[model samples]
Target: MTRLVAVSGSLRRESANTTLLRAAIALAPSDIAVTLYEGVGDLPQFNPDIEHDAPPLVQAWRALLRDCDGIVVACPEYVHGVPGAFKNALDWVVGSTELAGKRVALINASGRAVHCHAALVEIITTMGWIVVDQASPVIPVAGKNYTQADMIGNPALAQPLLAALHAMAGVPAMAD
Candidate 1:
């Protein structure tokens, strides 16, 4: 199975980015498995002093990133950049081989998240992740009334993410 870790940039439990990932999960192809990571907020602040004795949470987080075939992120823009917790979670793996050369699918889950998206792309690329070009489709979902149902039922919202997921799985995406 092609395992992918889907991370939401927003820390809220009912965030639009989270809904986008859930929708993607609902629309994923049979050969792909999407696992949502809910620990971004749970991760403690990043600090190098404790790298020698990494926390259990950090260990589990790194293990998942290392083992996954790909990473998908639905991020929101805060003050024209990434959220602290989301960036913190990513910071924990900067020098690790966990995400080296892993395929990445980036979805700008918010309407006003272009800057954040660009920043995220740069960060992921610098970390040795190959952000899949075809799968990095943008959909405006933040601060909207859209739900997981809208994401799954609406072709506009579902098709692009499905394409991204299929691309990550190295499979041809079907037309909706």
Candidate 2:
């Protein structure tokens, strides 16, 4: 099975980006298992002084990234850029080797995310990770509050989602 760990950029209890990751997990193919990782919000702010002996949470976070086959990020734009909390989470791994050569897919669950996505792509690429281009979509699901069951019931949600998964898996895109 292809094990994927998904991260949502929002810290809100009712974040659409979190819902979108759940939906993606539900819509994935049988061979792929997507697990949503909620540690981004729980991570301590990056501290370069303590890089060698990192905090327990940072250690756990890196361990998770190392164990996963791929990573998927569902994010919302904050003032035309990535959220500071999410950015901090990324910073925690800036010097780690966990993400090197791993496959990653970006899902922008906001209407205006061009700049944010571009910046993210650059960051992920700089980490030596391969960003699955076709799977990266600015889906604009900010306020939709969709759940797994809702996506399973709606082809509009399921199809493109499956397509994104397929892209990440290096398979041809699925039809809607």
Candidate 3:
């Protein structure tokens, strides 16, 4: 099974970002195993001064990313850009070698409004990670204008996201 480390950018108890992560978890193929690293909000501010020996939490986060086959990020928009907390989390990943050449997929749960996808793509690419082009899942809120209540049950939204996950996991070949 492919081991995937998925992280949500939001730390709110009822955040749409967290809800979107849950949706991704449900979309995972049975063959791919997903392990979520919660409490992104609890991580300390990234400091270049303390780069040699990382804090326990930072170390733990890095370890997971390094070990996993791929990384999935679900994020919300802030001030027409990436969330500060989300940016900070990415900062902690700078010194780690795990991110180099890793496969990454991004999902923005912002409904209707055009997201910061372009900006985020630039940032992820600059980090030396391979962002899957065809697998982009930018869910601009469909018809109902989207709300927490509208997210959970819609198979239409879920199916495409599932396809993205399957692509990230890389489809297995048929046996001879």
Worst 10 residues of 2 by lDDT: 139-148
Q: What TM-score number comes out for model 1?
A: 0.95
Q: Report how far off residue 12 is in candidate 3 (Å).
A: 1.7
Q: Rate residue 89 of model 1 by lDDT.
A: 92
In order, candidate lDDTs are 0.88, 0.83, 0.73
Ordering by TM-score: 1, 2, 3
User: How far is 68's C-alpha from truth in model 1 (Å)?
Assistant: 0.8
The model with the greatest lDDT is 1
lDDT of 2 by residue, 32-116 (tens): 8898999888888899999879999999998899999888998777888889999998888888875689889898776577888
Candidate 3 clash pair list: 111-141, 112-141
Q: Tens digits of per-residue lDDT for model 1 on 69-144?
A: 9999988888999899999998899878646898889887766677998899899999998888888887888778
Overall local distance difference test of candidate 3: 0.73
Ranking of predictions according to lDDT: 1, 2, 3
Best prediction by TM-score: 1
Lowest lDDT 10-residue stretch of candidate 3: 140-149
Candidate 3 lDDT by residue in tens digits, 1-176: 88887887777777766666666776576787777779588889888988777789888888888999988877776676877877888888866765799888787666543456667788788888788754567765423345544564676676666766777878732222
